[model samples]
Target: MNERTEYWWVHHDSRIQPAEVGFVGGIPVHFRFLGTAGQVRAESAELIERLPAPPTPVFRPPPAAAASPAVKPQISGSWLWFIGILLLIFVAQCSGPIFDALK
Candidate 1:
């Protein structure tokens, strides 16, 4: 069995460990935590803002085994056509066109 661990997907295809994801009021916890801030570094805010993604698809769970059914239900076309023809014939016989068809 695979054990659940704490991780966060960053950028687009890259993931980082020892990270957590949550929402505060509405904003993401990561942004609230690791968001751009004033420090000694220059252009830090621009780099964060210029990122291609909000890391939006970041915290989503990893792809796992499909829980849905693969094959869809199938019905016999021959049987359905036969039943439909029979019904049409029976209905038409009630009128004068196929008066002798049933008898």
Candidate 2:
């Protein structure tokens, strides 16, 4: 069997708030949600890890933001209002006919 030493900071102190860019004792570090390993990346100054932690997962900085902007389908407000008014007209027209037929 093989065993490897791993380092992780499971929880951060309440006093030290994470930030996009910050320094710890003069060492610079950028903080962001990696969404991987689910751990914050920092210098391994402290070897101790908090209890009830997940498996020894390595933490790495998130990838740089892509230059290409994400494009999403968008609907104009005018089109939405048009559709809603049309729906209301259709319902109003249908309801009168429906009630008349039922009576």
Candidate 3:
């Protein structure tokens, strides 16, 4: 029987083959090969040690005048006058019954 050896490109910490990109619940990763090993090896300590540390993320401030102040809505007095006239007409229509009830 012929025994064939296989090699995998793996993450250093997990010691498993790199998963397909955008896999649900998978770790977000950028892969860089440190070295190679025999198929049977569980871990590669030398490669893990030699691999460069991941770069630190830098924050950028937003533009100085990216946004403008929001304009507030205004009500015109004409609407208020219309509403008042409608209320006056409603009260005038009901005034006869109201006066009769008061007697």
Best by TM-score: 2
Estimate TM-scores for all models: 0.25, 0.27, 0.26
lDDT by residue (1-103, candidate 1, tens digit) is 3322222333322422222333345434332224534222221211122233334554788667697568866667879999999999888877675666667
Put down candidate 3 lDDT per residue, 42-75, tens digits, no spaces: 3231122221343333776765773877776766
Task: Output the number of the lDDT-best candidate.
Answer: 2
Order of models, best lDDT first: 2, 3, 1
Superior candidate under TM-score, 2 versus 3: 2
Candidate 3 residues lying further than 4 Å off, grouped into runs, are 1-75
The digit string of per-residue lDDT tens for model 2 on 8-103 reads 342245333222323455443433322433434544233233224334438876776896689876767879899999999998989988888998
Better of 1 and 3 by TM-score: 3
How do the candidates rank by TM-score, highest first? 2, 3, 1
Better of 1 and 2 by lDDT: 2
Q: What 10-residue stretch in candidate 2 is worst by lDDT?
A: 2-11
Q: lDDT of all the models against the reference?
A: 0.42, 0.48, 0.46
Q: Which has the better lDDT: candidate 2, or candidate 3? A: 2
